[model samples]
Target: MTSMDLSFRRSNLLRNQPIGRGDADPLPLLLGQLLLRAGLPTTIERASSRPWASALFEGRRHSIRLHFAGEEPTTQRARFIAGLSEAEWRLPKYFVADITVDEEGSDSEGQWVQLSALTIRDW
Candidate 1:
């Protein structure tokens, strides 16, 4: 896996808050880490996110579509899902509460996997 520096800049809305008390969206960064850990040669077909918050916690619900093309795409797709499900992710300022394969299918050229995840800020 390639090394990455995952840093978040405080949103202007939280500028007046105390240090370490800001919310920076982590979905984009988290998606990169998720792809890396899966270890599949693929492209992100699409990504979507919606903000979510409760009385105490703030986070996002994410959906990602990945396309895998080449030999044995079915096998590669299986491994991709397994990798994400089994591996433990240690990301900076974020917690991946859940990640799962929501849908999958194949066409003449390749296979695609759709994943859903819930991520929360650690700060």
Candidate 2:
């Protein structure tokens, strides 16, 4: 995976109070690390929410769209989902949010597994 520094908008501590727990800004970063550890060539791109999502869950503003590539598509997808499940387990205090992963075409690495995570800033 190529290395690059990416930054996202963080909620103001005193202003933007969250609507629920597990809305911290750290989930995506941890997710990226998980993808890397799985040995899948990956890239996490900071992204905006779907129009409908942005309208409904305005409080959860941070979205991360990560792409993973591997030789075996099924194995890689399973690994990623397992890692994400572990992450969700780590945050037992919060509600389990829905994360979406899809197959987005191929590159030099083989198959591209796209995962999007939407999280809220700490309030």
Candidate 3:
């Protein structure tokens, strides 16, 4: 398990909000921490939202796409999901809007993993 720092600037929309105040609040950060605790290399690139037709579509998902130092991406994904589910049960308040995991191949060869989440609400 390796730790990678994913640094990115948050949009003004997110900066002006309080901690865990909205759907797009702190899920990404919490998800990143969960991934790290699960022994996976996870990072949050950025977060933003879109407003349309009196609805607010927020991208609260932590997009984690990376190559592990010495691990298969598929295995990493599985572990991450499992860890996340467990963490979710332990911490019910923290929600992951949508989590997408991709494993192109099997075993520890040519495996690619990606995850993202979305938080939607009516504005």
Query: CA lDDT, every prediction?
Result: 0.77, 0.49, 0.45
Number of the predicted model whose TM-score against the real structure is largest = 1
lDDT of 1 by residue, 12-83 (tens): 437644335556667778777767755567788899887767898877888999888858888888777776
Candidate order (TM-score): 1, 2, 3
Quote each prediction's TM-score: 0.73, 0.42, 0.41
lDDT of 1 at 93: 79
**Winning model by lDDT:** 1
Residue-wise C-alpha lDDT for candidate 2, range 1-123, written one tens digit per residue? 897534522554456554334344445454545556556466655455431245434323334555555557557656666656446423322233555554455566555445554443222
Better of 2 and 3 by lDDT: 2
Candidate 2 is scored at a TM of: 0.42
| lDDT (10s digit) by residue, model 3, range 24-104 | 445445545655654634433343433222243433334455344334555664555564433442223344444555432
